[model samples]
Target: MELLYNNSTNYFPIYYVKGKVINANIQTYGGSEKMTYGIGLGYYNEKGIFRGTGYNRVDLNSTMNVTPVNRLNVDLRLNASLSNRDRTSGDGTLQSASPVETVPGDPQELSSLLPGEGSVAWNAVLDALKGTKEKNRGVRLRTNFRLGYEPIDGLNISTSLAADYSIDRRNYFQPSYMSDDDYSKSVGETGINLMVLNENLVSYNRTFKEEHMVNFVAGFSYQYDQTEYNGGSAQNAPSDKIYYAPAGMPDLGIQESNGTKETIALKHYQSDMQEKTLLSYFARLEYGFRDKYLVSFSLRRDGSSTFGEDNRWGTFPSVAAGWTFSEESFVKDNLSWLSFGKIRASWGRSGMHFSQNYLALGIMNVGATPYRGQATIEPEWVRGLYNHDLSWEETDQYDFGLDLDLFNHRLGITLDYYYRYTDKLLTTIWLPGIHNGYSSQWRNAGAISNEGIEVMIKYDIFNREDLYWKISVNGARNWNRFEKSYDGKDFGGNIIGKPLNGIYALKTDGFINEQDEMKVFYNQQGVSNYLSNFYKGAFYKPGDYKFVDVNGDGTIGSGDAVYCGSALPIVSGGIVNEFRWKNFDLNMLMAYSLGRHIVNNLSKAVLTNGKYALMTDLNAISFWEKPGDHPDYPKLESDRMNSMWSYVDRDVEKVNYLKLKTLTVGYSFPKKWSRKAGIDELRVFVSGENLFTWTNYSGLDPETVDITSGFDLMSNYPLARKYTLGLTLKF
Candidate 1:
């Protein structure tokens, strides 16, 4: 039997006060000769840093084993859970009015401002916490059963069946005070999903002459999944109190406006259903000689309903081999200190079928529209252009690795190098302007390649009875590129020969300092000609940014923009250390990343002099103010269009950081003391996460920024420091 409890709290700066978490679990197990059983129950709750946003869940799990016959065995497992999540934190209505837009003022004064109408940041926070509400509640259930029988030595057969089902309901409401139209609204949604799987396997294991061994296994599996969704929204609710129920709203009759009358339905509804299935057959064989040489091979064929009939099935195969040279007589006798050494290699091919259901066939939507002043049902245009030639996306990968252990296993090291290539990438292509009433078509378009090397090392410094210490370090470096495309077109920051998701921007040479300097530069660099050709001959001010002319044509154009950086990290790694003395133990973890860049969009927004508050930092003061004033940013002016400043090198920053990810210390009570209290063992621990960070990036928490777009637009939540205390008990 065992029991556990944990509690933690998160603290942030001015925007958030504190968030709390609570967790508890209980488990017990007992077994006899013929049967064994185990069961567990767990509960979790959290209060988010943002008001009116939190999550709660409860789950139960159980497993049982039975052996009714001499060579037959049966196993059963079941799991069930209920969870609820609050989504008010993601409300776009409040997000659009970000606190950063509020004018600078005292905290107490801001809080006293009028709700919904005030320009104070505190008002938006209050409205988000009280005026709007959204929540999703879900229930999930899963069960599995397996049976195995061994009729003869070195032979076994097994079959298993599993099923999962879940249901979810969401409710959202916004009062009239929170909307621009001064009308209360509500929305209701419900969804259900079900899946089932069945599998059967056969295997035989035997050793030949005690030095050579062979094993073989084969299996067949089938899976099916179905999902159904229905949702509706209603406006003009009677009152804010009538939430989560669309029926509370009433339809409004036709009314004359500008000599026109139109009927309006208070509620609008929509529904969707999707289903998919997969079937597969797989087999694998393994062989070994004297435990020093090993080889294995596997193959599988899978068929999916998401693909077209011509490409419904795909075949994948893999092979691996390993050799332990340390087991040879030469190493055993000559290199006695080398306890272990192995070299391994493998290669594999895989397929992906992730498109939406029924994408290979045309689809039509039905809706209601006004016809001759009367409501009529009509068929809308096709959802998307369909093509029956679509096939599965495939990836081929190869790996080679070496493992070594020295000093009686006190030091260990592992190194690996791998290359992966993917073709027939599943993506959407935009058609030429509303072709056949459709804007886009799904297609397999391009090829990409990735090559990387990873290394890991671990060492034991002290292995004494009372004191033990170990340290491990691991790191990886990868390079990714777009190898080929159908039309030789560049999109989404991917270039033909450059790294994927590269950042392209114009180079700048600080701000224009003086009018005389600008005049002399324009004459020599042809800035006047370039502006006239590209920017309608917009005149540049002394405080404006001066772009570089890379082509020496004396004008800056779109072609002058060059590749600056990439969104993907070139190197990333982590380090872990563990130590124990007597009954006390300690662990520390650190993580780092390099060669990634981010565009500080938040800085651009604040410096644009729009309807946003200014940042109270030294960077904000570095804007050019007058002639002869050299500055890092352009002059704070909103009257003219500054297109050159939109994408410039000034906004891109290299984000290299080393963070102390976690640290923990714990002590275990002596067994005698625990036994006196009717307990088998007990332990207590304290841990801290995100405690320290070292970085040159200007953004708040570089690790939390968006990796895909590499833009820090202030939409992501900042990482919070956390402290946790926990206890474990067993009997």
Candidate 2:
């Protein structure tokens, strides 16, 4: 039996709240010469920091092992869980609102506002207080049975069957006070997913002369998965108290008022179902000689239902070899300091099919359309494009690695280099001109390559009965590029010879502060009508941003834009330190990333002297107020040119940051006290997550910034700092 409890508290920059978690689990086992069995039960409950949000779950698991006869065994396992979650409407909506709309102003002024006539902050508060309520309930079950037998010495056979099933239901209700149209709304949704797997395996292991060993294994597996979803929404309920069920809403029909007929669709419905299957056969072999040299090879053939029938099967193969140099007499005698050393290399090929079903088949959609001034259900003329040539995306990868241990095994190091090349990339491509009445079609096009190196080191500084300390550090760097594409055409930011998702923008010079500076800039090459043409006929004066003319004949056009940076990080790593003294332990982890850039869209919106509220940090001292006054930002302006200036090179900023990811301190009670209390063990711990960050970024949280588009739009919820105190007991 075990019990755990945790208390959590949120930190600054966001609303302060307290939450808690409780977990309890019990396990028991009994064994005999012929059979053994174990059973476990667990319960968990968590209260979120936000109001009206919580989760509760219960789990049950059982396992049994039986040896009916010599060299024959049977195993059975079953696991089930039921969970319920209370979701708040503010999760995605209210949190994404701008800080200016949620943060309050002067308390005295806010207190004077009238009912229903308050500021944006007051309105946001009201909506959160009377918003929609949502609940999600789910149930899951999984079972597995296996049988193993040894027909002869060094030979074994096994077979297993497993099945998993889960279902989820959601209930949502929004009262009239939370909607802009003064109408109540309700929605209900349910989804079911099922998966089944069967596998068989045979293995043979033998050693010859005690100097050579060989092992071989082969297996076959089949899996099937099915998913079904159905949901609907209704509006204009008779009362605000009705929740989840929409039966009280009006029916769908035609209504006439003042000689005008209108369709009344109080409810909307939707449903979908999909099924997929996979079949695989695999084999592996391993050989070793004198415990110094080792080699392994594996091959697998897989067939997936998500691809075209003709190209559904794919074969993948891999091989690896390792040499233990320390095992040799030369290394052991000469390099005594080297405790152990090994080098290994491997190459492998894999395939991916990551698309929905029926991509290779043309299909028509059925919907209601107006025919002769009356609604009719008919098949749409537009249909999906079919490409029987669709195939799986495949990748070939190579890896080389080195491992070393020194100083009596107190220090260890690992180094690895890897390269991957992928072709026949499954992607959506735009049609030339609406082929088959579709704007885009799925196709296998283009190729990409990624190469990187990683290094990790660990050292045990102290090892003693009373005190111990250990530290580990790891780092990695990667390079990604688009190698080829269909017809050498650039699509979706994938340009040949360039990093994927590269940032391209026009460069900018310093702001124009003095008349002489402006004149000198305009007098450069291609100088005629520079201000009037580039500024889009706006009132260009001192303190306006000046764009650089990259090309000799440049007029601030798209051609002047150049590749600036990439959204992917060039270097990332983490460091961890652990210490133990007596019955106390402490751990700290730090993570970092470098060479990543992000567009500060949030700052551009609020810092350009626009109608939007400005941050407290920006003031008159930050912007240019008069001629000959040098400042960090341009002059206050709301013109079109000023808006475009937000996209200039200045807006793109490096988001390199070093953050303290986690810190934990724990203490365990002595065995004497635990024995007296009739408990096996007891421990207490305190942990902090997202405790601190050191960065030059101007965004709220650098780690939360989206890397795909490299834009910090302020729509993401800021990462919260949490401190937890927990206690655990066992009996």
Candidate 3:
């Protein structure tokens, strides 16, 4: 397609060190420039569903590191990914026209009103319309090891190992451009948090002398993961243009000669998605005194090949205690300026191994049918019964802490407060079946409690050197509840443990004016959260926005979209400074967040109104040609575009932000001009990243979407870059 989207050089990117061992000059070569466009519409009005996918993978990870012994380590990574996907998902056309599994870029023609009945109204058309203009190449190889020993003296030991290998490929453009039907890949993994680890544990510190001072540990961890998707599929058809495939599919008598199925292996139907192996046996015990009250206990045991029966075994435990109010001696003689303070508490139980393999049980599906005509029995996509209690996914924690270091440390603090309860919760839920066809499975539900508060503050204002000032401020606040219910259903709304890879959309309250239009309220499922009746097809109203109808039931729907704020940044933190004169160095970073939110669908599709194509050459003319001289956006040409939630009013604010992410200026040319350029070190750097943002956030780039998933990705990718020019030589 325009010569592989403008080819620049022979595709290359392969690096693997463990599994199949392959590395070719650790590659890299430039090529990436994008420009995309989108417009969408799909029907459904009687019972529905919609789908989506938008792509952008701008990758460049270059790695190189090697350290031998004293705990060996090695790493080699290469990634040159450019996946500019533009997806305008589809769905919403059903109702008496089943068999709608139309794939290949779905939307198989069906709009003469109601194409129903085995739907030839193009029955979910999409006569195979899948698009993926890819250029993927990934490589990785890693190795790490650790070892330590102390034969006697109280005995000690240590061990660790980590290995990883990866290879990824993509160049499957089918229809044309050029292809030998290519794709080759491989993967391998080996992890071992090995630890025969031991510490000052001298026989329980000689029988807990004077209360305590003991240590003991045990270890063994093994992990093995494998992956092999091996790609290749083709047998003609791009208007029969080439790229092999004369025979393969339904074999055209081995089509003119070019045909290879070489034993078809898409991991042989995803052989249980391969990769399996896990072994664990961990232990720990620590007692204390003289170091001022402390107690620790730990236990862990696990074994898995993806679980089955007795859940493949699992047991985790923990207990902790520490108290050293400045080592208590009358508070260490009146808090000698509080040199150090500690207060800790713990209670734990953890387990969770992302089980996947008969997810606790159930499998069987085979196909090949002809019936009475000789071949038969058909069914697919299996796996639904293998529960030996299907195992792990437990978290029970309760910890309270406070560790402080005042004066002498120039101010340091850590205050933690926790209350975790995860109970069962490995959900697959729903079970109330009818002939065992599907109700819900994958048990262990209810119980979700996450209470939190963490604060980390450290300030040095000056740490020596020519000049250095560091200020770290951590913040956390979590609140969640589900307490109990798998189906016991007293009420199940959904607000379980909020932050974890944030982004939980639909909250925007500014639009609607006319002296507030009497609070707008629209129910009967159009929701506006109570006030009543009114809602005559509102286009926008009110001093523009503010909503909170949590459950007075007046209606604002999605149960009023709770969990109000956070697309990440409920107070994020960072501030650093270093200034030196000798070799001239200046680095600065200031990051902040006081609340988070973002939707600005390009400012709601150019301030709502429509008629702008936006192909982005930025200014190739027409801002709406004579549009009240730009009345704060809302001036489109009218070709029918406007609809970015047209004048939002979802109620969820506080995107409060403050940033200066990074700024740097450096100089280091003298050292006799770096030992006469024989290079050991050379520096030249001018940097600026995300330079500035005050945030009232109208948005063109507020870190492009993903405020935590509700799928509102209006085509993203390309907001990362505020600048960098470089040079660094070290050989």
Candidate 2 lDDT by residue in tens digits, 1-731: 11121111111113224667777788888999999999999999877665455788999999999999999999999999999887633221211212112222212112212222344645665564447677778899999999999999889999999999999877777787766555566777778989999999999999999989899999999999999988777777777777755445676645566888778776777788888888999999999998899999999999888887688899999999999999999999999999999999999999987547777665456556677886555422343566677888999999999999999999999999999999999887777774445766677888999999999999999989889999999999888899998778877767788887678787777767665554323455655443433554563467776666677543566667778788778889999999999999999999999989888765456554321232323343366677666665677666665334457787788789999999999999998999898989999999998899999987677787777678765544345577778887877
Model 3 agreement with the true structure over 22-141: per-residue lDDT tens digits: 111222333223212222222111111122223333434454444444333333434333333222221211111112211222221112233333534332232222222223344444
Regions of model 2 farther than 4 Å from truth: 1-16, 88-124, 252-262, 368-383, 513-542, 551-558, 607-621, 629-632, 641-645
lDDT values, one for every candidate: 0.76, 0.76, 0.50
In lDDT terms, how accurate is model 2?
Answer: 0.76
lDDT of 1 by residue, 1-731 (tens): 11121111111133355778878888999999999999999999877665555778999999999999999999999999999887533332211222112211222122211222333543555554477777778899999999999999889999999999999877778887776556677777778999999999999899989998999999999999999988777777767787755444666534456877678666777788899999999999999999999999999999999887788899999999999999999999999999899999999999999648888665555446576887664433444566777788999999999999999999999999999999999877767776477777777788899999999999999999899999999999888889877688875457777788678788777777765554333565564432321554565557778777666654566667877788777788999999999999999999999989888765565445321122324334577788768676788677345463486888898889999999999999999999999999899999988999999888667897777668766555556687888898999
Question: Candidate 2, residue 105: CA error in Å?
Answer: 19
Clash number for each model: 1, 0, 37
Better-scoring candidate (lDDT), 1 or 3: 1
Q: Candidates' TM-scores?
A: 0.89, 0.87, 0.26
Question: In candidate 1, residue 614 scores what lDDT?
Answer: 25
Best by TM-score: 1
